[model samples]
Target chain A: MQLEIKNLTFAYNKKEGNIVDNFNLKVKKGEVVALVGASGSGKSTVLRLTAGLEIPDSGEISIAGQTVAGDHKFRAAEKREVGMVFQDYALFPHLSVEKNIVFGIDHLSKDKRKSRVKELLKLVNLEGFEKRYPHQLSGGQQQRIALARTLAPGPELLLLDEPFSNLDAELKDKIRRELNEIIKKVGVTTILVSHDREDAEFMQAREILMN
Target chain B: MQLLKTLKKASPGWFLLTAGIIILLLIPNLNIIINLFGEAGENWEHVRDYLLINYFQNSLILVLATGLLTAFLGAGLAWIIAAYNFPGRDFLSWGLILPLAIPPYIGAYVYQGMFSYTGPLQTFLRNNFQLQLSQQYFDFMNIRGAIFIYTIFLFPYVFLMTKAFLSRQSASLLESSRLLGKSDSTIFFKIILPLSRGAVVAGSSLVMMEVLNDYGVVKYFGISTFTTAIFKSWFGMGDLPTSVRLAVMAMLVIFVVLFIEKLLRGGRKYSYSTSNIRPVSRRKLEGGRKIMAQIFTYGVFFFGFLLPTAQLLYWSFLSRGGGLMETLHFAFTSFLTGGGAAVLILTGAVIIATTARMSSNFVSNLLARITILGYSIPGAVIAVGVLLFMLQLDGVLSFLQMGFGIEANVVLSSTLVMLIFAYAVRFMGIAFNSVNSGYEKIGESYFEASRTLGKGVTETFFKIDLPMLKPALMSGFLLVFIEIMKELPLTMILRPFNFDTLATKAFEYASDEMIYRAADLSLVLIFFSTAAIYLITHHRRRKK
Candidate 1:
């Protein structure tokens, strides 16, 4: 399995009951999985837990056979080698498209990092957009840049939280196809949280309906 | 039926609080206006001919010099701590604000005691290094010295404001800059500084207003600024009109500063360009740079807080007869008065903030703006207004007493009531801002939800708003309490005969050239204010 979770229970505070209660999931290598649920149904919480943005109350989360979070041992988000495309795309507003794509690959040599960024930009069909800030991009274009940035890190697993929610219906289908193609081409294991049935259907991923 | 319907439609608590705040805010400024139209006092000619120009020149110089110096020091330190991860950065980040706990007047005395001809620094140099320095080189009792004292103590206002602004910035932007192969210095100059211009300006303006409002540092240093001019005209020359005139001029200068602040921020939005606002992440420095960063941070902490604090500790114990008993008494009394004033201000602030949150009517908005005017006006100016208004009120009470056969004299002004009232007038703005932000964070949706569930406005507020606003209320109270504890000018002008708070006691001893005796009391003030600041900042950090 590329990613595995067992018996996750989590809550922000004691007063509010567990947001994610005994949630369990597993994904095979290079497989894409979708967790579909309405708002406040713990879909995003599960994604965040997988990304190490929030700690689980009782559970084990592993990426590429490494237990990143469980029991007394927990890894920080940056050290977990997990990539997340947030609902808002979370692009660095002050950095251009090319710069953001290379943000997580600083360990690469200069020429190699630049070439990698250029390759990802071409893969996401964002070539020649090296100078534009996030604010200047369309929502669809911004989502593409977010995906490219996450993919540039070469993580074993990717978490997308409401990736299609910010797009219009007309742009959503087109971007959905393009995004799926790029992810499949890269062959990165992916977990996507969505509320739309069409998004799950178009991604051709096995869906888990969260309560 | 109409009256009850109108009452049901509007919260009477809101109207009552707004009206009360408006009256309280207006009385001081109204007194000044009425006094401006009155006849000139005997010394008005002397002040107008000779002293006015000096007052103008001195105040302008102090404000400009202090503003620039504080901005440079504050913004530089804020950037250093905000962006760089060095040894002691965590401690130094908040430790730099400790100077604010020591009042500027007390700082002046401590610096003086450390550098005087017979003081520790010179004596140590002579004994150890066989160095003989001229007295002229060590003399810091002048305009430049006053500016130095004010900047060292007041720069924290800029530092804190700018640090807060920088810390809220998205960390990813900086990380991306680094990933782009830009150096730390390049990222700072190109990205960090430009984004923090608004905070820098806001902090500098606060420093300027504080300089204009100060009476102690200037008075002790013998610099003839507007605040000291007002004091001299009123106390030394016994000229009320001239003092009032000087105060009005000072108020005008404050207004000009505020206007320029507004102009600088004109049409420039400072909100984050994206919704991902991670707290700023500090970049660790290495080797020599790390050592240099540590030295710079500690050096600021030393000169700004530690050196003065060490001097105070030494003096407090070095003095002959122990003033610990007197100091304890003053502490008790200061706490009592400050606590009382904080309670009253918090009550008033909660009502006003809740009302403003409940209603966005023209009247509520205007009342909100009016109440904040007290903070911008100099403390001494507010004291002048409060004194005049209280005297008139006392006169009315005396007339009523004669008609009713009562024999009490100086009804309101003779007690601690007037001083506490003056504190409420001046520091209410502090409480209001905290509580208002609390209200804003809660939003109107909760209130609307409660109303739809068949609760009245009063019920919704007590059950929903109060519980949610506990943190804000507590912080607001603590902030106001600390301000009242450290307050000097208002307490000085309005305290009853023979009344003494810690601030007044310390000031009296220092002015009497018995700074050692003053240290015993000043230390108590610093300890309490520092503890409060520590608690408030710590609580905020934990919440984040």
Candidate 2:
């Protein structure tokens, strides 16, 4: 299993009931899984917990056989080797598309980082637009760039929170197919959260209903 | 062992940086508290028996009166500008904040110079109108005069905060109140006032803090507030212990005020539940009401900023002499010191703010909060604390010298370094708040995204946080720089014997009754501060 979450429980406040209670999930290597739920149904919480963006109140989350978070040992998100695409496509507004993609790969050689950024740009079909800032890109284009940036680090696991929610109806199906192809081509273990049934069906992934 | 492991696993650099800054910030205040428990000086009895009650009475009256008056003027203007459309409303919206550029002490002297018996207003009245008014009628040198001066210059605190609050308030609530047969005045009293109580308390507490912090105004006006008492005991009576005692008393009063303010703003969060947050639209007034609104706002702007500024300009232009180079030299020194201190403070603030952002743990939050305590304490108090701390350090150095044959004398005290350190302590909170707001606006999503992209904390901060926080860093620097330039009490207390900033220079000339000579320096101070105010407000409005 590339990603495993066992008996995970989380709450924002103790007085309020748990948003995610006794949640468990496992994704095989190179597998794509979609967690579908309504708003406030802990769909994003599952992804966040898996990626170590949030610490589960109780239970275990391991990525690629490395225990990322558990009782008495909570690894930081940065050290977990997990990549996330935030719901809003929280791109660095200040950096150009090329700079943002190469941001996570700074430890690599300068020439290698540059070549990887170009490869990711080509993978996302944004080959000619590396100089544009996030604000200058269309919503769908920004989403693609967010995906490419997340994948730049070659994380063992990738999590996407409502990835297609920001797209329009006319472009959603096209972008969804394109994004699915890119993920399959990269062949990384992935968990995607979405409210739309079409998004899960299009991704050709096993669906888990969250409530 | 578990706790130690957790601490070890957490970001040590962030924890240590925040802890170190907090310790440094608190040392001056801690010194005051420690000294308060020590022996009382010989004059302590004299102060307690004769002068203590007077100080208490004067400070109470000044704070209360200024608080009420500023609340009235500030809230009233805020309401008018927020809820109504009238002539100069746009100008008054930001223009009202300009008075903050003129320090209250400078305002005090300018008013005195204009209204004193032999001053311009009285002289003009006697010369042209043949109205030889009595000294009492023209006098603005008493406690009442101090209140007037403080209210006019300090009400912008209430105005800016209340206006910001009222502007963001949901309009539907007011509309519903009106539709339910409530009159405008009735809705204002029964609904608006009740909802805005928190903002009023916040602004009033700020006014009270500034009023208490003031040494120059009360001292120049001959009003014996606690700050003035502290200065007198230290400088006039040469009694450091008594000064510390007075500072502690002042801090006690501030603690009570802050506590009351906290009580007023209880745990109840006041936010609109729905996303339908349509701001209150302005009502266009016609005829008499429009004219009245215009008169009220313009009158405040005129008296608070323009009139005093005009007088300063006139005096400066009239008194052009050989001292022009000397005045420019003081301005340069002021800029250099203010710039240096602002840089140091912003650096410290950025570290603390970033740590507070990166680590959402209790320790970091507490450290950030503790560092801001210096801002609320009076500058004179901080000066006393700084003085005591530096003196002790000097004593330690001399002791080491006696034992080890190393020669070092008062390295930190009696130098520009002491003054800059004092500025950092006094103004670090201002810079921190500005940067914190910037951090708050950007939110944690970007940082979290960076972390999830396999970037470490330090790498993420350098790549993501710093670039995003540039605007905030600039604004914080500018705000602290302007404040350092306008600061009087801290600079006056901590500066080297022969050192003079624009503020101290202006104050010296004004105290010596050379108000004309003071004008050149005052104009330079106001020019920089006013320009900064305009830039800050412009940036804020653009952000909104």
Candidate 3:
């Protein structure tokens, strides 16, 4: 299994009921799955737990057969080797498109980082947009760059949180198609958290209705 | 062992550095508390029995009167400019903040010189209008005049803070009130005031603290407040212990006021349910109301900034002799000291602000709040504690007498390092707040993304946060530099022998009744300060 969860339960506050309760899932290597649910149905929470951004109340999460969380042992997000694309595409506002894409690839040699940035930008179909700041780019362009940045440094698993939510209906179909193609081309085990179940079928991923 | 392990994994170097800085920062306040019960100076009984109550009464009255007046004028002006689009509103919005560039003490002397029988107002009445006026009517050397001087010069603190608050307030709040058939004044008095309590309290507390810290205005006007008494016991009566005790008393009073305000606020937090908030858009005013709004802001600006600055400009040119080079010389010294202290203080601010923003630990948050308490401390009070620390260190270095024939505690008498250290202690809050607000605007998503991208706390700060936080760093440095330049009490108390900054130099010229000679230095301070304030506000408006 590329990713596994056994009996995940979590809550933002104890006074309120659990946001994710007794959740279980698994994904094979190179698999792409969509966790589909309405708002507040814990679809995003499940993704966050698998990414090691949040720990469960009681559960185990293993990535690549390594027990990253549970049994009083929890690895941090960076050590878990999981990449998250935030809902708002939290691009570093001060960094250029090239710097942001190569932000996580500092361990590479200078020439390697330069080529890798060029490769990722080309993959996202934004090969000539590396010099612009985040504010200068459109919402759709920003989402593409954010994906390139996340994928620059290879991760064992990729988590996308409502990546198409910020786009208008007119542009959503195109961006979602592009993002789905890139995820498959990279062949990383991926989980896409969204409210739309049809997007799962459209992207040829197994659908897990969270609620 | 578990707790230790958790902490060990959580940015230990940054945590330890923050802890060390906070402990070092608290020493001055702790020293004052410790010495409150220490050996009494020789004049302790005289101060305690005959002078302390009068000092308390005078200081209390000044704080309360000035606090209320400034809050009224400031919040009133802020509401008018923020909520309504009146004539001259755009220019008045930034123009009103210029008054802060005029130090209150300088305002004191300028007003006195203007009101004196031989001064401008009387001379103008006698010469231009051919009408003689009674001297008693124009007297601005009393406590009432002190309150006036302080309110006019310091109200911008309240204005800027409250205006920022009102500018971001969701428009739905006012729309709902308007739907209930409430008039604008009714909505303002009943809704806006309650919602703005936090900002108003924050701004007014600064005003009251400024009034408490003042020594120049009170001394020059012959008013016997707590600050004047601190100076008298130290320099006049040669009683250091009594002077320290008075400072501690002033510090206690300020903390008590802050405590009372917090208690009154209780736990009522005004939080928005949605992140997407539409800001309050201004309503247009026409006819008579438009005329009044224009008059109010411009009138305040005219008196608070224009009248005093123009008068000083005329006097400086009239009195110009061989002081141009001397003025530039002291200005350079002022810039260097202010710049050095600002750099040191902002560095500390960044450390603490980043730790507070990134972590949710109780101890770190408590430490950040304690650091802000330094702002409430009067400068004369900080001077006592800082001077005491410097003296102790001087004594430690005195053991160097083993090698040379130097005296034991002579180091405190001629060191700018001591003065700069005190400046850091007194002004850390200003820089901390600036950096903190900047962090609030950028939010934490970018930070979390950096962490997930395999960067540690320090690395992420250097590579990501620092570049984004450049504007905040610039404004914080400018504000701190300007404040250190205008500072009077601390400079007077802690400066090395024979050294003078623009503030002390201007004050000296005024003390000898040479108001004209003081003008050159005073205008030099105002010119730079006014330019900085304009730049800060201009940048803020552009960002908005």
Of the native A-B interface contacts, what share survives in model 1? 0.00
**Residue B20 displacement in candidate 1 (angstroms):** 1.5
> RMSDs, each prediction?
18.3, 2.3, 3.0
Maximum-TM-score candidate: 2
Per-candidate DockQ values are 0.01, 0.58, 0.44
Candidate 1 chain B, which ten residues in sequence have the lowest lDDT sum? B1-10
Comparison by DockQ, 1 against 2, better one: 2
**Runs off by more than 4 Å, candidate 2:** A14-18, A196-198, B1-10, B400-404, B408-410
Candidate 1 lDDT, B1-544, residue by residue in tens: 2232223224676668667776886898889978998998888888889888998888888888898898888988999999889878888888999989989999998888789988999999999999999988788798888888999999999999989888888888899998999998898789877788788888988889888888888888888888888887777877878889888988988888899889876755768767878887777899999998888889888999999998899898798548878999999999999988899999988887777765434545665777778888888898888888888898899999999997775489746988988888888788999998888876654454233223456776776688778889989998899888888888887889999999999998999998888999999999999999899889988987
Residue range A13-92, candidate 3, lDDT tens digits:
66789999999999999999999999999998888778766666788899999999888887877787888899999999
Q: List runs of model 1 lying over 4 Å from the truth.
A: A1-211, B1-10, B179-181, B361-365, B408-410
lDDT against true structure, model 1? 0.83
| Candidate 3: regions farther than 4 A off | A5-25, A36-61, A67-74, A204-211, B1-10, B127-132, B175-181, B263-268, B397-414
Steric clash pairs (candidate 2): none
TM-score of 1: 0.71
Calculate the i-RMS of every candidate, to one decimal place.
21.2, 3.7, 3.7
Ranking of all candidate structures by their lDDT, best first:
2, 3, 1
Per-model tally of clashing residue pairs: 0, 0, 0
lDDT tens digits by residue: candidate 3, B370-458? 77877788899988888888777777678776458765545764389888888888888889989988888888778878878988778
Question: What lDDT does each candidate get?
Answer: 0.83, 0.87, 0.87
